[model samples]
Target: MNSAKKFFQNLAKYLAVALLVFIIVSPIYWILVCSFKPTRELIRVTPTFVPHTVTLFHYVGLLKETGFMTYFLNSIYVATGSAVLVVILTSLAGYSVYRCRYLGRRFFFNILLAIYIFPRVLLLLFLYPMFARLNLVDNLLSLVITYVGITAPLNVWLMRAFFTSVPLELEDAALVDGANRLQILFKIFLPLVAPGIAAVAINSFLMSYGEYLFASILIVSDRFKTLPVGMAQFLQQYEISWGWLASGSVLIILPPVIAFAFVGRYFVKGLTAGAIK
Candidate 1:
């Protein structure tokens, strides 16, 4: 009877988890399905879960007609630049906070946490004017800088946690062998915390890739606009191109999905790094 009761409990738990997953994933699945469906089928009174006619019309048009490729490349540059900068800056800062003895180290970390508590939009008030003065207002560099600022504070905190998990004995041993701070950081600490670095890269890239508000306001020239802002151009005053929108959405989601797919194991390890030991 106890075994039978435990079996039913486990069954119920699995069923609940399955239901939650379905609820979360069903909308994304619908968008993928609709991206390939023709306009007539998309606008039909009755919804069809499966497309009777699968067409690549929207995808082809999206590439050929729109400046999507430019926007895509722009997003890639900005996001990649931002992610790299964030990883470098945060890893150094986190390591310093973890390893160094300083008077205001706790105070510095508290300030970072405090900055991260506020919405990034609020920073734009000061950021826009500063960038405008520096002639970076319409530049991709501005976006990269903005993303690093927003992503770095939180990532520093994350990296610091990872840094703490590394035993100090390793650092002492490296010092005993006459290795300098940079060598210790590069050879000993970084390799051991590689999962954490991957996690930070993914976080920074995703944040920069999909950001719309700052991208829209900071970028003036159509040529330099990121994917999110460029995608909004599909919304004309008269009509919204649902097919193009759906197709674009599917394409925009691919990079982050691919990144996570490749590095997801590392991300999981990063999060659970110190949990067991």
Candidate 2:
């Protein structure tokens, strides 16, 4: 009877985990199936999970008829650039504060942390005038600037915590070997924190990839539109064309999905590195 009870418990646990995984992945699977289906097929009375009349029409239409390809390229450039830039800036900034001792450091860093939790919408209003004065409105560069600022704080905080766990002895030994600060960072310290750095890259990529709020407000022209804003317009314009929208959306979401799949382990490691230790 005890063995029987244990078997049931194990079965229940496996069932629960399977259900959770299915829930998480079902939407993505649905989206992919819909992307390949014909519009008529997608909206059939009895929806089929597999595409009955699979067509590349949606994918081809998205690229040819709409400016989706351009939007895709813009998003890629922005996301990649933002990820690289933020990782560099935040890593450097966090390392400085985390490892170096200086005056007013705690006060300044505390203020940054406080500011980190505030609403980002506040910046849209406050910086509207400043951005207009600088002629940055509707500019991709402006998007970069906004994204960098938006991403930097939380990433810095994450990185600061990550850097705290690096053993001081490693750094001290490098210093004893007559390595300069830059040498110590690039050669020894940065390599040690590469997992955390990859995590930062993942965070920055996702933020700059799929974010809607700031992109919607800041970018007004079709020429400068990123994927999220483009998705909204594409959906509204092709409201009746479910397949097209779904395909476009699936395509739009692909990059971040690929990025996370490749570096997801690093993100998990970085997030839990100090937490467990």
Top candidate (lDDT): 1
* All-Cα superposition RMSD per candidate: 2.1, 1.8
lDDT of each: 0.89, 0.84
Q: For candidate 1, lDDT tens digit of each residue in 1-277?
A: 9999999999999999999999999999999999999999999999899998999999998899888999999999999999999999998988878788989999988888787577767888889999999999999999999989888988876665577878999999999999999999999889998888988899889899999989989999989999999998755633888889889999999999999998776666656663455
RMSD, candidate 2, Å: 1.8
Evaluate model 1: give its TM-score. Answer: 0.93
Over the stretch 11-121, how does candidate 2's per-residue lDDT look in tens digits?
999999999999999998999989998877887899998877888998998788888888888898888889999999988888878888999888867866786677888
After superposition, the stretches of candidate 1 with alpha carbons farther than 4 Å from their true spots are 1-7, 269-277
**Lowest-scoring 10 consecutive residues by lDDT in candidate 1?**
268-277
